[model samples]
Structures are given as C-alpha cells and as structure tokens.
Target: MPEPITQTEYWNGDVGARWAAMQAELDQVFAPLTAALLDGAGLRPGERVLDIGCGCGETALLAAARTGPGGTVTAVDVSRPMLERARARPAGGSPIAWIEADAQTHPFAPEHDVALSRFGVMFFEESRTAFANVRRALRPGGRLVVLCWRALAENAWVHVPRDAVLTVLPEPAPSPPGGPGPFRFADGEALVDLLGQAGFTGAAVAPIDHPVAIGADAEAAARFAATVGPIAGLLREIEDPALRERALAAMRQAMPAERPVRLGAACWLATAVHPG
Candidate 1:
C-alpha cells in the first residue's frame, strides 16, 4: 500500500479544491459558529491577530473587520488551494496577509494580540507541540480562542446525515486514537489540560450549542451535508458509482421533513492566555 498522506498533502490536494469551490456555502453553513469564535476572541480595534487554518479566509476576514484598519491579520493554512481562494476574495478593514504554510510549525511573529480559529486547531499532528507554537506567536497576555467539535454524537448536523449515508454504505475505519480529526478534542477537560501543558495559562473550555441550517430545504440540505464535512470525506473514498448514488439518496431521505433543515451543532469554545 502507498504511504498515508500527511495533513499538508491531504488539505492541499483534492480536498482543498473541493473546500475552495464550496467556500461561500461553507461560510454560510458555519456562520453561527464563526460568530461564537469571534465573540470569544474579543478582537479589539488596532489589535494584531493571527488566524490558524484560515480556510477560505472567513474567520480571518471577519477578524480583520473587527480589528479595523489599524490592525493586521495573518491568515495561515497548509492548503494552497484554500489559501488561493482566500487571497482572491475581497477583504475589508485591516490588511490581511494570507500565508500558505502549516500553522502547526509556522514561525509567527510574537506580537499578535489575539489568535483565533474556527473549527480549526484540531488537526495538528502533535496537539501539544502545535499549541505551544501558537502560544509562542502571541504577545504578553495575548488571547487564544478556538472552536472545535465536542463529539460526533452530539453534533446532529453531522451524525443525522451521516446515519443516512451509512444506511447505504459501510462505516469507514475509525481514526487512530488521539489522531487528528474533527473530534480530536472531544474531551474538553483533556483539551484544557493539553493547553496548560503547552505553556498556556488560564486554559478553559465551555460548551457552545447552536442550531445550524444547512439548506433551505431537505434536498438542498442533504446535498450540502453530502458535499462537506465528515460525510463528504467518507463518500469520497467510495469508488462504486452505484453505491455512491445510494448513499446520496439515503442522506436526502434522512433529512427532516421540513423546509429549512436545521440541526443542532455542539462545540467547545476553548480559551487560553499566553503567559509571556
């Protein structure tokens, strides 16, 4: 068998292109969670900010707006396609520097006032080392806020459609324990402990629950579900065309018989401070 791809290659390859193509839709789908992350960040005017895994530039653009013209935004991601898409988009407020590099090991200037990530920060190969690098990028007393999925079971926005798809296809192999994935930080306590161990102070995690509308209708919602996130990743691995269609049908049928398919998304709003 061929060697498994690294996170950098995984994101910069086809997955990155797919995400870039769906950037606008994904932004809309994740708007609420983005708001929660930005709120937790508490970005101030003229405060420099760093955005990790700044996919398609949503959070970074928003952070730039919050920080205004006097501030600067450094948006970093490993995916070149996503970074290109982000760079192409129009931005307002602070100037943005889009850097295509691994945030896990980037040598960021230690002068940022805040660092933030939305649905990011969970894919690092070494969580402790990655967070330690992030901590090193902050100025004294700088804040770090991140949003990560709490658990697969608690996220109806994913599992609901995922269950439907699974009805037609077999479940994919589980990721290795403590491996990088969306739910890598499901255990809030462990995450906080890891943050502390990474040399951050005042580490804490709080639950943030919100309902997300994937689409205006069931069909649309199912399409959106089957095109992004974990379900999308699962579907991509299947080579059988017939099996793929069946799985897509199941996703559509699993949607609630309602106009707007809104589902619960449970995440952890984790925060830490750079002790300088």
Candidate 2:
C-alpha cells in the first residue's frame, strides 16, 4: 500500500504567513483571473455555486455578484490564514459563505448548480478521491470549472522561481511524487482522467491567458514570487543563508525593471458536467 499524500506543514507554518501577506499585496493581480474564471463558468441568476479551494474567496465573491440577489455562493479552503483574509473582504448584500476545510473530505450539500476554482484545486494528494468528493457535493447535473496551470513550461509561477530554485539549491533534493502539492493538475490529460474517474463526464480543457501584474516595481514582484510560490518553498529549504540571499538577489534581477510590470500567465480552464 502506498502512503497517502498529505498537506505540507510548511504551507500552514511561517510560509503560510508570508504567502498570506503576498496574496494581500497582489490581490489586484488575481481579480481579473477570477472574473475570467467565473465568467467562463457561465454563471447565472439564482444559481448556487461552490468555490472549491477558494483562496481568500476571490472567485466566490464574484459568483455572488453574478448570481445576483437570490443566489448563494460558498467558498472553501484549507488555509485558515487565507480564509481569514477572505472574510475581511468588504461584504456585499449578496449571500456568500466562507469555510476553512479540506476539499478532499468535506461533505457537500448536493444543492449547488456549479463549482469553480481559480488557480486552486491543484494540490490534492489523491486527486481521484478529492474530485470524487467534489462531485458528490453537486446536484445531478451540476457542473465544475477550474483554472489551473497548464504546465510548468508555460507559467512563470513555476519557471521564474524554478530558475532561482535550481541556482540556489543543490541538485535532486526532490520532494516526493504524489505528495500533496500545488500544480499537481498541471498535466492536462491526467486532470481529465481524474475527473472522469471521479464520475464527471464530458470535460473540456481550454487555454486561458491573463495579464498578471506582479508588483509595482521589480523588487516587490521578486519578493512576491520568491515567498509565495513553489520555488520559494524549495528556496526556504536551503541551509545556507548566503545561498538564500543569492537566490533572492537573482530573483530581483530576473524580474523586469519596469513600473507596473506585467507578465502573461498561461492556465487551463478545465470544465465538466455531471451526468444526470
């Protein structure tokens, strides 16, 4: 039997704090992506939506707006810090519920018309079971749409920090495969397979491009990429302070020296519907 993959403690520890801070600072960068995600989900009036892995409720809040006065939106995440920040968003008169819970195990009410995630749903240790649980939360014909990185080759969220990670850290300090981590769904074929295995039928994977404004300047952007991304965790694992400092320096240099620096992000819109 294989050992089950689990969430990294680093995400909830000091790393999570820095990640939260970075999220707050770059909240604007995520807004347009969230809008695009929900819009693609074909949001409608009086619909009940679930925002899975909804880091800070960005998509959930948008769902609330799309659903108008009579609809409800629920956003869930495992990160308490993320949820706290999400709760602090200025309340609108629409119904939006925020919960801190693991998506893999949380019970769903089977009343939702749609489920969505933006740059979320990529960290499941066991995607088959995790998605099965998500499938259970929806009505017979309920649908799901998510924004996940298409591959490491295409997204700076990986490549930028990866460039710094390889330089700063020694070779082959490899984290375990099948371990609970982000971008696990980066493989388009595998993601579809998992959804099919989870009882979802007729899925489509679509390419999505959005402008990501990393920071106002190169420095803030560098810090943001270094602290909250996949590369940052690897960088943090290094033992030498000198190497760490060098990594940060390289990240700063890697960033373009421009005001309101914009980077194009590539993601996949994986959408599916439940068979009635």
In model 2, the runs with Cα more than 4 Å from the true position are 1-5, 8-10, 238-240
- Estimate, for each residue in 1-276, the C-alpha lDDT of model 2 and write its tens digit: 976434645446676567576666656876677667877899888999989887766677778888888888888887877778788887563598898788888887888899888766877767889888888888989999988876666777457757765676665565676555566666788888889999999987888877688788878777777776677667767788987888788777777666876676788889999886
lDDT of 1 by residue, 112-217 (tens): 9998999879989999999999999999999999999999999999999999988888888999999889999999999999999999999999999999989998
Model 1 worst lDDT window (10 residues): 251-260
Q: In terms of TM-score, which candidate is strongest?
A: 1
Model 2 steric clash pairs: none
Off by over 4 Å in 1: none
**lDDT measured at residue 106 in model 2 versus the true structure, 0 to 100:** 86
Residue 197's lDDT within candidate 2 is 91
Q: What is the model-wide C-alpha lDDT for candidate 2?
A: 0.77
Each candidate: what lDDT? 0.92, 0.77
Error of 2 at 112 (Å): 0.3
